[model samples]
Target: MYNLAKYQKLKNKINRIERAELGFFPTQIYKLENLSARYGVNIYLKRDDLSGFSTFGGNKIRKLEFLFGEILEQGAQNIFTYGATQSNHALQTAIACRRYNLNPILYLVDVIGEGIKDPKANILLDKVLGAEIKIIEFKENEDEFEAMYRAKAESKNYAQEISESEDDYYLIPPGGASPLGTLGFVNAYLEMKAQEFKEDLNFKNVFHATGTGGTLGGLTAANKFINDDIQVHGINVSHKDDSYLKEVAELSTAALNLLGIDFKLSDRDIIVDNNYVGAGYEIPSTRANRAVKIFAEDEGIFLDPVYTGKAAAGMIDYLEKGKIEKGSDLLFWHTGGTNALFAEKKILGNLLDNHI
Candidate 1:
């Protein structure tokens, strides 16, 4: 149940923190009528995809609002971030940098080795935004995380050469997963609660794709803060180790602390289903592509193969497997990445196949 007093208190705490005006607030939450009928559940969508600043809006914009606020306040000129070549976070960071007249420097890991030669999708958009793009190629037998760590190290060296002092630049973690960035989604949760009050609907389950865990952390923190019973289920978009859940829990606690909320999140509070990662990050899956097609054909809504498609697949699988109760209220957070549909063929992986 939502407590108005607690909600107001939390909002006041968040009001004291600095944040840039970025995307449209309280992104429309409406029922997925066709899907709800098909699944025998009340299906709703939190349309973060329509979160504007661009047509390619996604969940990263939420984090960037808080991150850019801090960057502007600190008078940082260069903004450095990390992600895959087609990372929505990297693209959104570049967009935010452009908005604030800050220099956007990206150390993008070559997750899709084939897409590096010619720009497409987010990479093309990054170029158009005039971001200083640095592609970090993978070494033989090197994993994505290893390459990302190397990219961060390289970024540090580059920053030192270009800037007079550390204060002259800001380094945002991959996917903007820091405590400050997590505050954005905490604000998002509060916004959703306000909508719930207006709509007279109570969502019991929330499904969203989880990459670096900042969004999940913030949602979990906000849920705990308001004493809501909503189960925030993070559908893993990539292969994460056991420690990932612990890290998200820690992040949630940190965000709560920032809001002066005396609550802490535990592993028990974070629910992540890891069954639908398919092959790996950015590699399109058969089921995910099928899910994308279904959303497009059935609801006239588009979902990307990388994140939202896979998350929708997980939600469908849960419905089929009876993991989610029949007639239960489910809210799918559409953390947009539809631009990845235009990326290289390697990442698309038979997404256009008729069989899907």
Candidate 2:
């Protein structure tokens, strides 16, 4: 479905860009036996979950490679960023900082207002990583957009202020969704394609959870470059409107532009299905919880409630609804947030219920 020659060409093209070796590359791609039998489709998994630097390896580690390379190139000693209290990106950033002995300052917004003082999951990891964390809890009846904007504005203001005074600080955008960060996934796309080629697998669909848009942007851009028959699917794990779609499309172009690839990405290239985001952000749904359990039970693989599990739910629904034909080749990109399985109960959403 993709060219092996273009894979080498992409490598030669992106090798010019500086990047830190933060995690082991070429994450495993393998088929799921039980799930494939159940779904009546060839369901394979790209185990980016096993991406190692720490045991908490995730898709964020890929973004960090390029991001930290840029940071080290600039000789940055301190870094600042924003995310939710339990963000996988924030925790991964902290881990990367520890490796470089760079100080990490995380200004986190409390989307769920679950009293994060007793940290769990990624928040606990941040503390272990010695990240200076400032949690922002929203006021009663406050608008979510207002709260998010205010938190980000304040975080950047503080970062800029500190940078002006004592030392320069590198500020990464939330979820590391910057154009440079998106390049990590562009590289990831090439890597996965190479694996598929080596295994002689032809995938018709590639599905993953989409948040912050960087990963999706990179994938869309690379898919355009390869012109493969594969359908890149982004199952929205959170709220996203047409504006978000357009923004991601622009980011796709920007990432391709960064790679010196002259390609224009349209709205058609970015296929986002927002149907799986039940309730709201960080709020788990029944389908997602079931999906998480199903993966764990059937394939002995873990999927978190927030991201990959929701995406799994979408793929499951598609299979059930005949959106994916029987015997079709499908690939699920496990972006890795299994830590959230041990997170707060509110987010877990009875994932442990109906147990033996």
Candidate 3:
């Protein structure tokens, strides 16, 4: 059902956008033979976890390739981003900035009470990269969202004070959810489509973790662009309200517009399964821990507690509940955050427990 002419046109439109080479292209896609047998469906994986720039690569690398391209084009020297103390986005941004010789300033919220002592996982990686790190703790009566908003405001003020000129610094939103960053996943969607055509396979469903919504927005936009019927399902890693779908739709439309595409996406076109977000973001769930072990033991692949583990658990649940039809073809996008395995015990939960 893929039209070569249309695909080529879309590819051309995407190629016109500026991008910095950051990660390896078309990060491996292959069949998950063992899981397929277990689930009674044809299972495949888009290995974005191996999307390299570092050994701990993840989904953020794709967004940074475009985001940094824009920052470099504008000739900014200082890059400021906000996230949790162990944010994969913040870590990836710091890595990309180091490669481009730009300064990375991170305003990170302490969501898991990492405290002021020795840091671990991505936080430790940020320090090793020499990023100017500022940890923001949640004040009394403040929730995670409030603390995140405060972190952004505080980072903006700090950037203004340190920058010699407005052009000297650039601010990136958490998860790189901006339109330009969303374009990275739009490109990723095309990459998957190309693979699908080459392999003569038609995927009925696509699954991945959704946080700030940029990746979901881009993939949805690309699906709309090609008029594909593949159902792209986002498994929430955190709590999000009904408005989250609308926000993702807006992001998708904006990214499509950047490519001169006239198609628009609405909330009706988005799909999110929130059933797997056990105990909210960064807090591991029993099913997710079980899913992690299953993947490692069966497929020899690792998934982080924060993102991929939750999404994978959701996919498995759908299959088990008969929400997805037997014999359906499924693609799981491994967006990567395996570094979190070495993070705090709270995030890791009972992952290694024999009873999980």
Candidate 4:
């Protein structure tokens, strides 16, 4: 029931302007019948994990579709991005840049433990992509780190010293949580709606990891435009309790504007749970471990520690707590971080040993 007129018009425009080649075809949406029966709700899994982008399929590629388009259109031949040493966004951006014939300069900070010697996860894939990496000891907030990178980038000798200025472009933060990036998920909402309608089922709850806040915000705004009553729940993957509400509010408004839909949003539509985030970003939690093991054992599914595991844990906890009424259709979005499992396999050794 979206503003069909506006939705179609925007879709036409995106089709005309965006230069995205199909990296992934429709990721499957299948009913988790066993889980549904157990939870007393119609639960469905949106398998964004099947994206087929590269070594590790993920939801970031969807956002990168728009980002790379802008890079190409801007006549940029070199790209710059920042992230953790093992960041999926950094790894995937490297891949996208190579595919589009762009050189990538990755400024990875914090040459720390576990991620240094063992690049088995996304870090290994990043090296495979041939992205020129610069490792620095970043020891401050994002604003501070960004300021340092900007100062470094703006140095007269940076591009000249690196020989990358000829056609340079910049990529934003991890999760690619900008307005353009969020458009990818906004479109995803529409796609999901199409599938839902085709299957003749209306999902009441939509769940995903709220890392950078863009995906959840975009999906929520898209739901409003589509005029659907679906609730989008974001399980926090980082400490954004105070700021996430504002971020979602602002981004959702931007989404509404892009779709040309007239609507106002409140905080009630956005649900975020920080309880299961564990120690911090990229660190695994006991709850997440249980969820990952359960899903793998029961459903033959693989979820990573950083994203999918936490989100799934959040959904399961809600079910157990009776926060979600029984028999309500719930959708769990698998944002694809299965590769993170390989990085944390050491943590799973006891379980692995038992199984062996």
RMSD of each: 1.1, 1.9, 1.1, 3.4
The list of candidate 3 runs beyond 4 A from truth reads 2-4
Residues 1-356, candidate 2: write the lDDT tens digits.
56657667777888889998889889988899999999899999998888967898989889889999999988877788778889889988999999999989988888888757788989998998889998888887775566767777887788777675434678888888999999999999988887887998888999999999988999888888777778999999988788888889999898878888787888867899999999878999889999999998999999999999899999999999989978978999999999998888889887878751
Q: Estimate the overall C-alpha local distance difference test score of candidate 3.
A: 0.91
Better of 3 and 4 by TM-score: 3
Among residues 3 or more apart in sequence or in different chains, the pairs in candidate 1 whose N, CA or C atoms overlap within 3 Å are none
Global Cα lDDT for candidate 4: 0.73
For residues 165-270, write the lDDT of model 1, one tens digit per residue: 9999999999999999999999999998888879988789999999999999999988887889899999999999889989999999998788777887888888
TM-score: model 2 vs. ground truth: 0.95
lDDT over C-alpha atoms for residue 22 of model 3: 85
- For candidate 1, what is the TM-score? 0.98
Each candidate's clash count? 0, 0, 0, 1
Taking the tens digit of each residue's C-alpha lDDT, what string does model 4 give over 1-356?
A: 45777566555644554745535857789998778887888889998887756757678878788777777777876677766676677777888887778887776654233545656677777787877876655445554246436535653245565555655656555567777778778778877877888988778889898887778877887777656778888898766556678778777777666555556667766777888887776766777877888788778899877778889889999898888878777899998878777765543333343332
Error of 4 at 171 (Å): 2.6
Off by over 4 Å in 4: 1-13, 138-167, 255-269, 344-356
Least well predicted 10-residue stretch by lDDT in candidate 4: 347-356
The local lDDT score (0 to 100) that residue 229 gets in candidate 1 is 88
Which prediction has more favorable lDDT, 1 or 4? 1
Candidate 2 at residue 235, lDDT? 95
